[model samples]
Target: MEITFLGTGAATALPLPFCNCPLCCKARTSGGKDIRKRSSMAVNDDLLVDLGPDTASAAYLYGFPLEQVQYCLQTHSHSDHFDPAHLITRLPEYASAGVVPMKVCGSSLTLKHMSEGVFREDEGTDMLSPEGMQKLSIQIHQAFPYSTFSAGRYRITTLPCGHDPGDGSMVYCIQDGNSTLLYATDTTSFSQEIWDFLISYEFHFTAVVMDHTYGSGINGEGHLNQDQFIEQLRIMRKNGIAGEQTLVFATHISHEGNSTHSDMEREHAAHGYAPAYDGLSIRI
Candidate 1:
């Protein structure tokens, strides 16, 4: 599977407007691969996880066929993770596609709020009907652990993401014929329940792109810092859940992560996993 990290910053973005912190300043001056945006990604050119506010711009900038994407699985209703207002443009009025409408799935809050929030606006979404859902192959399934959804060539199993009240988030154990990938983010630490679920599973994980919103000794509730990521990596390696060949990447970064993305890179390299950046394409 080819996994591409379209954008890797948190909602506010590195160099968040007006915050003259060290991280933001370094991001402003740094010119190479260090430029990052909000978190969102494309898998094997078909499946997508999260539709952050950055999607439209990233789609244009990174050269992914945004409208032609197969499945869009939302993790939660967080505006940073998913901004349906931005996604609604692809529905009917903004971009006219000759093919099927986009498939969107998530928890109830994600789907319902997106529908009420975006499609109902200025009648910009008219072609979207129940038939469009069928046409695009968009099926809303409850994001409970171990429940699998088979759509053509991909087999998607939803796992729990640690965050929020009862609203919920998810991790996808996505598999094709031979390889499997775990798309997990927006989780602070890998919760014990989720850890147990992965331990019970059989496939070798090719890659894992996770939230590294914090860096070093900083702490937070719903997101993982660099130190936390290192801890989790150790756990995975020790438990045989992952190995040397299994690539680990940290993403969903904030400008407050450190002085620069290099700081994050150095720290992550010390732990052995690279920090995921925008437009990074990895094949597994």
Candidate 2:
């Protein structure tokens, strides 16, 4: 299985549009990996994990085959992670000739919001009818926590996350053949119930992309810092969900985190953690 990180920064991105903080300034001056877009990833060119506002530009820049993505898994309703406006372009009129419909799975709220957006224009007028969406050939599935679903060669299970108090968030564990990947982001430490659910599963993950909204310090709830992330990884190890061979990566970074890519790599190398950058690709 191959995983491609389309974007790695948090909602504000690495260099906030109008900020002059040290990290932001450095990212602005130093190009390359220092620059990042909103968080999103594609697996094996078939499954997309998020549809951030930057998806289109990032896909063009990184040469992502957006037409090949068959499934889009939304973690939550957060604007940074779910961008319905961009997804509307997938309609047959705007997409490449003969592009297939993309199956999208998320919580009920997420799907509802996306459907509402696709059916109406920004001004709230009726833009597209059900027949139009049918012609466009889009499918929306509501995913339930702890339930399993299949998308292509992947068997996916959803885990509730500690983000958003109302409906919470969904974290995905996708297994294809011999390899498994845990995509966990926009979340803080797991709850005991979620921890138990994870421990019940015996498969080891090939790679895990964790939440890193806060780099080294805890700025708020519903997000993990570097220290908290390591602690959670330790628990996963104890539960046999991860081991020495599991490739660990951190994403959804903020500019205010105050750590550069090289600095985070050096600091986290001992723990087998790598700070993910936009366009980073891994094969498992």
Q: Which candidate should be chosen as best, given lDDT against the real structure?
A: 2
What 10-residue stretch in candidate 2 is worst by lDDT? 120-129
Where does candidate 1 stray beyond 4 Å? 119-139
- Global fold similarity of model 1 (TM-score): 0.89
- lDDT per residue (tens digit) for residues 177-234 in model 1: 8777877777768778767877887546778777788877888778887778888888
| Per-model CA lDDT versus the true structure | 0.72, 0.81
Residue 168 error for model 2, in Å? 4.2
- Superposed by TM-score, candidate 1 places the C-alpha of residue 220 at a distance from the truth, in angstroms, of 1.6
Tell me model 1's lDDT, rounded to 2 decimals: 0.72
- All candidates' TM-scores? 0.89, 0.93
TM-score of 2: 0.93
Model 2 CA deviation exceeding 4 Å by range: 92-96, 119-132
Instruction: Give the CA lDDT, 0 to 100, for residue 45 in model 2.
Output: 75
